[model samples]
Target: METFSIHPIGYVRERDGSKVLEVLPEYRPALDKLDEWGHVVSVWWFSGSDNPDTRSILRQTRPHQSSPGEAGTFATRSPRRPNPLGLTVAKIDRVDVEQGLVVIDRHDALPDTPLLDIKPYSPGSDRVEAPILPEWAAHWPKSREESAVFDWAKEDGKA
Candidate 1:
């Protein structure tokens, strides 16, 4: 198998209770004009879950109530995969180019999580007009804004 290397360009931070992505001094230049986009796609590492055992978990039962009883790792967004990477599309609240800080509305990453990369969220390519979902998840929210208020715990039968 071919191997690849990945180095974090920055780290996620918590500033005054707000989530922020602080790019390293060397990568700050990449943030140039990023503010023009209203949202960004953050690629981060699942640092805490990266391990031999986790990486070996290829199947999960009841990963989510809306999912099948058992599913392959690729079928669900389990952090325990061949590659422990996480992707999140976050709404940009603010961006400070000089400081290389990006304040986002929310992210499913832990503070200090290693940030792999950031790309402007282009709707033309990122948004799907009609996405096919299993019957179980057909009732889920249709938009990110709606998802913010959606009761995922309830949908997962954990509420």
Candidate 2:
């Protein structure tokens, strides 16, 4: 077996202010020019996951927040898996060099998520064709224009 090691460039400070991550010192150098970008893609490890005693008996149902469905850990975004890794794209709301951290507008990741890698979300550099998704997954629930309408209706309660 081969062993590997990694360090974090920076950590994600959630908008709510209840969560924080201490990025590894070794990888701190990578943050030199990171904050200039408006948004970034974060690849992290679910370090705080409540790992199940038996991997074979992991849950296959979706959380209460989503529609009921059965899926393997790989099929759904379940953290309790062989490798508890997660990826999220978040807007860079603020950066604090002195504090050694950056704030993201939105993050579903739990506290203590080990920051693995960070990449700028530049359209010219990261753009790609639509990814192949599972049949059950819906590609972007609404369009940008439709989202505006939905947002307005949600606030007005006129939907």
Q: Report lDDT per candidate.
A: 0.91, 0.60
- Supply the TM-score for candidate 2: 0.64
lDDT measured at residue 63 in model 1 versus the true structure, 0 to 100: 78
Name the lDDT of candidate 1. 0.91
Whole-model alpha-carbon lDDT for candidate 2: 0.60
- Candidate whose lDDT is highest: 1
* Per-candidate clash tally: 0, 0
List the RMSD of every prediction in angstroms.
1.4, 6.3
Question: Which RMSD does model 2 reach against the true structure?
Answer: 6.3
TM-score of 1: 0.95
Report the lDDT tens digits of candidate 2 across residue range 1-159: 576776655555554664443455666566677779888778887777646542343565653233345556666566667667788777777656556566766565776666878778877766556656444444333333344334332322112
Candidate 1 segments exceeding 4 Å error = 157-159
